[model samples]
Structure formats: C-alpha cells, structure tokens
Target: MTPNQATSSTTAHLKPTLGSLQLWGIAVGLVISGEYFGWSYGWASAGTLGFTVTALFIAAMYTSFIFSFTELTTAIPHAGGPFAYSKRAFGPLGGFFAGAATLIEFVFAPPAIALAIGAYLNVQFPEINPKTAAVTAYLVFMTLNILGIQIAANFELAVTLLAIFELLVFMGVVSPGFSMSNFTKGGWAGQDHFSLASLPGMFAAIPFAIWFFLAIEGVAMAAEESRNPQRSIPIAYIGGIITLVTLAIGVMVFAGGVGDWTKLANINDPLPQAMKLVVGDNSNWLHMLVWLGLFGLIASFHGIILGYSRQIFALARENYLPLFFAKIHPRFKTPHRAILAGGAIGIAAIYSDELIKIGGQSLTANILTMSVFGALLMYIVSMLSLFKLRRTEPHLVRPFRAPFYPYSPAFALICACICMVTMIYYNLLIFGIFCLFLALAYVYHAMTVGKRSPMQDEADSNSMTTKTPAR
Candidate 1:
C-alpha cells in the first residue's frame, strides 16, 4: 500500500453525518451566546451610542472576515480549521501559533458563557450558585458532545432556533418602550455629543464589541465532518453571518432604548433586565425571557464545546498535543477524550473566576477579553494565510473564492490588527497573561511536536485529509 493510504487507513476519522442544515445550526449556535450576555459589557465603557458605533465597525470586520475565511475552509476542509490553513501557507511554526490562538479562543470562551448560564438560572432560582451552575453546564454539554456529533448537533439546532426566536420576541415585546430619545441620550461615552474625546473609550470597548460575533469562525472546524463541505460551508457561513448581524443590531437597539441603558450595560442577563423594564418583574413575558434566554447561552456553550474538542483532537492528531487527546471513542465515533479535557479546563476556569481578577473586571468580562484577544490574533493569522496561499499554492482548488479578493481580506486584516492593538492597550495585564501562555506553549512545542521530521509531518498532514474532496 502507498504510505499515504496506510497512514489514512490507521487513522480514526470523525463520522460524516452533518449536512447544510446542521452546519448552519453549528455556525450560528457557536456564536449565539454573545447575543445573550457578553456584548452588553461594551456599554459600560462606550455607553450606548459610542458602543453602537463600535459594534458597527466590528460587524463590518466580521462580515468581511467570514466571506474571506470561507475560501480557506472549503479548500482545506480540515478539523484543524485555521491551523491547517496556516500550516499549508506558512509551515509548522505558523500552524502552531494559529492553533494555539484558536485554542485560546475556544477554550476560554465557555467559562464566561457557562457563568452567564448560571447567572440566568440564578435570576429564577436565587439559591442556585452561578459557579456551580457553570460547572454543571460544562459537565452536561461535554457529555452530550462525547456521545456523538449528530445527537449533539441536533440539540444545537434546537437551542439555536429557540434562541433566535427569543430574541425576535424580545424585540417585538420591547418595541413600545424603544424610545429614540432614550437611546440617543448619553449614548456617546456617557455624553449627549460624540467627539474625538470619546475615541479612547470607543477603542477600549473593541473587545466587548467583538463579543457580539466571537467564535463564528468555529464553524470551519466542522468542515471535516460535513457531507458536502464546499456547498454546505458557503451556505452556512453566509446565512449564519447575516442572521447574527441582524440579531445583534436588533437586540442591541431594542434593549438600549427601553429605559436607562446604563443599568443594562454591565449585567449578565441584560435581556431579562431590559424586558422587565418594559413588561414589569412579574409579567409572564419577563419570566419567559429569563427561561428562554438560557437557550441562547446554552447554544453557544454547547456549540463551543463541540468546536474546542475538535480543535484539541486536531492538534493532538497533528502531534501538537498529546496523542491521548487524539483518540476517538470506539463505539461513539467521537473525540471523547478531547471533549472531557476541554471541559476540565473550563470547569477550572469557572472555579477560578473570582480568584483570577484583572483590572478589577468580573470573571465574564476578563475571560471575554482574553477570548477576543485570541480571536483577533487568529483572525489576523487566518487572513494572512489566505493571502499567502493565493500566491504560494496557485494550483489549489478553491470551490468558493472570497469576493473582492485583495480588498475583502485586506479590510478584514486591517480591522483585526486595529482591534488587537486596542485590546492590548486597554488590557495590558490580560494581554501579558495571554503572551505568557503562548510562550510556554511554544516552549513545549519546541521540545516535542516541533521535532517531527519532514516525512512524519507529511504523513500527519496526509492522515488529516478531508473526507469530501473539494468541488
């Protein structure tokens, strides 16, 4: 047998069961949590008006980014997502950094979402501790993911649909209270007027603004398991981005206009709070908002568990992580070990929430910032890979080319660079912590996985080949 055939024969692949519908579910579910809670934190720094402006620019970046990123995803269609793209374009070291950054984005994001899940439940049952609920969420969803992909994906679709419906209902119910005067008053950096002086707060708010659409790129990680990646991926990505952008703007505007926007700016359950302003605390609609809002948080939490596990599995399969994590469950055909490992890290972060304070920010805020930092770095790397591969691998089969080519990716790249700089400036301590983690990861890579010879590296890459050929 050929060496590539032998290598492929021995490797355990993720079962191909997901299609366009499930792909859309995974894409939107992966990011639905941002709508539930994290984005409101931007209001604290930039106020309603300034934060709205920040969100617009951030939204543009994501719209352009997903359009550009889809090209790389369809061409490679690997579980490693950005790691695989960077590896092809810039070799192993580039892959290592991209993988590390992607890991940070996926791994760190869940704890914050889990905590929000807990906070939402706490609103109804005050006795339930947020941290306990957070850890419980990690355990429950990880088990679901470990059981199988289809089952987990089906669940994601259900919750994502419910979440989307809830947001629409929220906007509809709050329509009466959405006064333009309330929204525009003190909107720009807590001032009635917008000026250059508001720029720092606007810049500082970039990470929170990014929270609105963070992890949407995680959909690419599922490319390996797709039934028809080329067709399904472009559909899922384009449809998902449009859906998320609409919900983000709708929820933000409706909530901000409902009364004092400042009161909803820094809380975990902003939707429920905003709804209570319109419908009263005892209103069934308010209760419904609290209950249904869990769907949004759960969708993102569960979806991210799926995203992070695939990433860990991909890294391990490529030798960047321990081989133990690469093992697929015999009967279930899922990356059980990788799922449990990521869940453990998330649970640890949950327990450490209060303990790991930076700049006096809440655990959700701190972790959200860290996740955005990772995301922005990965975005920069992924766009660079796209540009490099066009020049380097001219013969590569691209089923879906990013429109506007140089300009599309360049705009995405510039925006990502700007966001990264602003995040570092405002979050020095968290940025340092992020750098230290990368440095340690690099050292570990240097000692172990980085030592793979050319032949071995080729074999590893071959073993990771997509199940469906590019169109």
Candidate 2:
C-alpha cells in the first residue's frame, strides 16, 4: 500500500476488534428496521402501488449513495465518517456541518426506531400503551450499548439472524395465498386509489422509504473498530445495501398486491396483517412468530444507538464538540461518555410529541419527515465533498477509488437533491424546520468552538521543541 493508504489502513483498525460479517449484519439490521414507520406511512399515502414505486426509487438512490460512500470510506478509513471526509476536502466549517448533520440523523433515528417498536407492540397489546413501551425499549437498548461494543455486536448478530428467519417464514406462509389479481386490482391511477396522478405521492414517499436504507453507511462509523477497515468497511457497506434491497423487493413481491392497499396501509405492522390475511387467522403459531419480528425491530434500534454513539465519539475527539465527550474507557476502550450522551438524547426524543402520536398526520410525522429531509441534505453535502476532493487532492492515495469518478458522485448528489425537493413539496414546514436547525447549529459551532488550524498547532509544537531540545 502507498503511504496514505497505509495510514488509512492502520487507522481503520485503531481500536476494538469487530469482524466484517458482524458489521454487515448490524448495518443491514439497522437500515431495514429504520423503515418500519416509513413502510406503513408510504402504504397509507399511495397504497401498494405507490409504496412499491417509492421503495424502488429510494432503493436505487440508496444503492448509488452506498457505492459512493464505499469509495470514500475505503480511501480514508476513519471514525468521523462523512465529517472527516468533508473536513479533509473542504475545511472545518464544511466538516462541522457534515458532522452536525450526522449527529442529527443518528440522534433522531433511535427514537424513531423506538417509536415504531412501541407502535408495533401496542398493536399486539393495546393495554400496554405506546409511549411506555417506547421508553422501555429505548432503555433496554441503551443498557445493551452501555455494556460495550462486543456485546452489542453479538446481540445485533443474533437479532439479525432471527429477523432474517422470520422474514423467510413470513414469505413462505404468505406465498401459498398469493393473488395475481391483487397486483392490478387497485389499478394504476388516483388519490386514495393507486394511479398515475399518484406519481407525485409516490415520489414523496421516497424520503420515507429511504429511511429503511439509512444506516447502511453506518459501518463507516465503526471503521476504527473493524478488524481490517479497508477491506471490511467496503465489504460491509456494499453487502449490507444489497441484502436490504433484496429483502425489500422480496417482501413487496410476496405480500400480495395493491388491491387491498387501504387495509394494509391502515395497519402499522403490515407483514403481520398480510400474514393473517394469507393464513385465514387460524395459524396461532404464525401469530407468535410474527411477534418475534418485533424483536428484530428492537435489535435494529440497538444497532442504531451503537453506531450513532461512535460518530459522537469521533466528533468529540476532533474537538468539534466538548472534550469530555472524547473520553474512552481505559479498560473497555469504548466511548462511554458519547454513548451515554446519545442514550440521553434518545430518551428525550422518545418523549417528544411527534414520537407519541399514532398516525402520520401529527407533529411526530412532521419531524420524522424532516429527519428524512435532513439526511438528504447531509448526503448532498457529502457527495459534493467527494467531487471536490477528487479535484483538490489529485495525488491523495485511494485504495478504493469510486468507479466512473465524477459521474458516480454526481448521480448521488442529483438524487439526494431531488429527494430533498420532493420532501419540501410534500411538507414545506418540516423542511423549513430542518434547515433552520442546521443554520442554528452552524452559527453555534462558528461562534462558540471554532477549531484551530492544524498549521498553527504544528508551529506551536515545533517552537516548544526548539526552545528545550535537551531539557
């Protein structure tokens, strides 16, 4: 490897030792589970036809973005992820926004996942209440995270396996009752119905559907902990995206058709409802197994918290945030402070009005939509950085350069911008709120804790050395 590649390789395996397969499992689980709410909302918005088209659009964009990230991540395998890449390519200000955007995505995502789990459980046990269940689930995962990375990875692996198994069984039981007529029964045109006019609605749902595909890039956050970051990060990144797209398509194809879109859309956990419809309500065994799927959803949340905390830790180390947040446990070598901070934010979000609401019509729905908007904004910035870096650092060693160069990054940038525009069209208020927060964060970072230039710090160090060479 060249000098830069060697540095990248060394930094990639800087800390705790996590296997490639385990990382891939965690990434897949987090991305798939994050979409539970989106799937339900998309189905409600455009029915089955709308949901399927939206799913395809989001999946395609996500696939392309992951490839772009794979190239960047392998070239510079560091823990700060997009933030580090942006800083190197642009400067501190650009890096601040990228890091802030990531922090928003990670912090908000956990509660969203928790809320989905709570909603699903509430469906099975209405008396328990969604808020209580949501809080309880969040706490459980927080505890798992506090325990440490190895334990979290092991738990994630187990949950992903069970989730995959549950998906297969669901597909098998529902396949026997598949109806070809269901595909075209609802027609391909209308508002409450599925039609060509609904195309806008379908496009609107892309952001929501994209939620399910969010955490695929999270593997990059764990780069510092992976066994062989150059090889491991890219493999996990590509592999995770492929796995999720395949599963999503399979589920959409197997879960009957858009004819009963209204019924399926109304239900929070569509897979269970679809299974119930397929098996005539006589399969008690299937009901229990469907509930097991909830565990998978919870596992996905666990992975989200784990990955998000690491990003926080990385930012802290770079002095973008408080130095205390950079603390790593001496024995565990894990970012306990950052993990606790993430857990606290997640707990707060769980209580937010948006998370407590039921349907997609409430403030919680607005925020969830805004989260998608925020994520796409970050994507736009990161993709731009990729192109900028190529021009500015032509000789920078890149172990894995993105294929097609400008075209690949350009494609991702365009798709992300399109998604953001669609989000604004659907709900201008939410997008406005998202941009407002980012602006506020940028101002805060600039005024309160602007990072010092590396050259200045280097000069100070050299002066000190020259003043006392033998002391």
Candidate 3:
C-alpha cells in the first residue's frame, strides 16, 4: 500500500512471453502501417520538398523521444506505459490525462489503418466494400489478441518481418523509374511561389509527417510482458526506430520520384498509387505489391489493438475506469474485455465514417487528425514526466538514461507543442472533437473514480501480480 511496496510490485497480469525479438516485432509492427500510407497527407498540406522537410524534422523528434522514453518504461515496466510514468511524476490527474491520450492515439489509429487495409483488399476484390472489409479485420485481429499474448506476439513477428521485406521489394521494383524532375515537378503545391503564406502549409504538414512514425511508442506497453524487461526494452526500441527511419525515407523518396506526388497526396493507398506509375496498370510487380503490401497495414492494425488493449487493461486495473474492464480471462490469462472494448470502437468507427466531415476532407482525414491530436498530447505530457521524474525521483533505478538529459526531452517537448498548435490551427474541428472526447472521459472519471487515493491505485495495480499459466 505504500510507495516502496508499490514500486516493488509486479502489477500486471499479462503473460511474460515476449523477448527482444518479439519486442522488436511489436515496436516495428505498431508503426509500419504509417510507412505504407497516411503520410501523403503531408504533401497535400506542404508539397514534396515541404513535406520532406517536415518528415526529416519529425523523424529527429521521434528518434530523440523514443531514446528518452525507454528510461521511464524500464523503470516502471508497467502495461500502462506513459500513464505509469506520468503518475509517478504528477499523480492521478496526470495519469488520467496520459492514459486517455494513449487510448485515443492507439485506439483511433487502427481504424485509419484498417481502412487502408480495406482499400488494399478492394483493389483486388471489387465486390467487397472497403468499410465492410475493415470491420471484418477488426473482428479477426482483436480475437487473435484475446486468445493469448504468445499467439498475438508470434503473429506480430511473422507479419512484421514480411512487411519489412515487402517494403524493400517495393523500392527495388520502383527504383529504376526514379525521376528527380517528377519529384520536383510540383514540389511546392499550396503556395504559387513560397511566401509568408507558405508557413501555414509547412506547419500544417507537421501531423502528416508524424503519421510516418506515430505509434512507435506502443512498444512500451509491452514492457511488463517482456521476459527480461530491463534488458530487452532498450534494444527493441533502438532497433525498431532505426528500421522505421530507413523505411520511411526510402519509401518517401522513391514513391515521390516515380510519379506526380500530388495525385497520391491524400489517398489511403499511396504506395500502390505510386507504383502504378512505374508499372502502368497491369504489371505483375504491381499486383504482388498490392497483395503482399497488405502485410504492412495488417501489422499495425493488429499490433495497435495489442497496445490499446494493454492500455485499457492497465487503466481499468488502476481504478481509472470500471473494474470489469480490468479482468483477466480465466483461461487465456489475457485481457479479453479490454481487447473487445477497443475492437468495438474501431469497428464502430468504420461504419461511423460519414457521421462528421470537416473542411471538405473525407472522414478518413478527420480520424487521422484525431490520432495525431492524441499522439501530440501524449508526447507533451510524457516529455514533461521525464523532467519531473528526473527532478523528483532521482534515485529511481534507471537502466538507461537519455543521452542528452534535459536537452533531448526538452527539444522533443518543444517540437510536440509546435505540432499541437499547428494541428489545432489546421484541423480546428478535429481538435474540438478531441476536446469533447477528453471532457467526457474526465466526467466519467469524476463520477466513478475521483475519490480513490494514489495508494489505492497502486494497490489495485498490484492485483495483477498473481501467478499465471506460462505461455
């Protein structure tokens, strides 16, 4: 019940089946969908060159943030990820915000990726509606997640490996057609000739640039599930980031070079559209990419379900939500309720796509912005937690310290704030919707969970420490 006891408790019921390889798979799988699509929205906001600049800057921010986040994850090693760190730093209110932000990020991200999956399938089977396919995907993957962590993680590793190789194949097939002239043909779209007006476009491009590496932080959710938490966490994060950066840059440059970047600028299937230029309409290479390419989207869509469910399970276990959601399955030893809860939301999103439309963009853009909104907030609060923890819990065991200390976290925070502002400015409607969701979550917390003390939360979290069947 005390701080010492809470810190020493292994308060997570999730199975400890993950090793460094599985961690690497989940980390990379969580964000690989971004490399497949959603990033071209940046081109719509800021042209080829502008989006490229945005991506480079955002990549640096993510690389630094991931390095810093590992310290907190290794120390707390909880399923809550950012929520656990922020709670230690700023107490219950802070933890609530971080958890809600994470739920929004990981929960909403899948719908976007699922839609992309549907789009890929529709490319082959015209009879199947994209939204219908998306809903089916949600059912299939979330069930796999609930069955067990070992099964889920094994699938993650297999699919992620396939996805990585697929990206490489895409580059090889399209490399010969790379053209600098095409890449720069309409490199700057919004501004007729760069001006003060161009600043807004470039700033607006921030979130879309972020789409390329958005949920890389999801790996932290697996910390409690790692077979060797302290040793595997850092290696997985470092290796995952390195892999993503390489893929992001390679795919972006080659895709841009192959055709008029503007055409694929806002679509959910940018890579397929990009390759269409090189192979015309019927090349076997194009068919192969479209079919095999589904692996990348599936990896993220599936892996994000894992991340969000862990977050849901963690928050519920800590009494931030109803306790039933925290229940571990009696037979599977997995958080079945939490996985179903998130999957229901994702499936609902597929059908609810047309409910609200903003700025003439499709429902997909709104969902994408919502995810970015959550990610930006999580980055800000998590970065703040890093500073607070360093000052308040200096003696806490940290297996890895961020290389630059204050500077690395501080810089990531600065970039996060700037992106948050730009996203709000560009997608005011989406930002407003996010605010409404946050407000409703807080209201629910106040009604059912506001009176709980910090120690009680720790005790509740400790409930997960019971022995479980080995995977």
Top of the candidates by lDDT: 1
After superposing candidate 3, which stretches have Cα over 4 Å from the reference?
1-12, 190-195, 458-471
Tens digits of per-residue lDDT for model 3, 1-471? 443233322343777779999999999999999999988888887888778878999999999899999878877788889988887778778988999999999988999898999999998887999989999999899889888899999999999999999999999998999998777776765543566666667888887889899898998898888988778999999999999999999999999999778898889888888899998878998899998899999999989999999999888877677666877888888989999999898888778856645678766777888999999999999999989988976767777789898899888999899889888888898888899999999998787554466566666434422233222
True-structure Cα RMSD, model 2:
6.5
Q: In candidate 3, how many clashes are counted? A: 0
| Ten-residue region with minimum lDDT total, candidate 2 | 462-471
List ranges where model 1 is wrong by over 4 Å: 1-10, 462-471
- Tens-digit lDDT track of model 2 for 93-155: 777888888888877777766776777787677798776887888777777777778888888
> Candidate 1's C-alpha lDDT?
0.89
Task: Give the Cα-based TM-score of candidate 3 against the true structure.
Answer: 0.94
Instruction: Give Cα distance to truth, residue 32, candidate 1, Å.
Output: 1.0
Best by TM-score: 1
lDDT score, candidate 1, position 20: 96
Q: Residue pairs in steric clash, candidate 3?
A: none
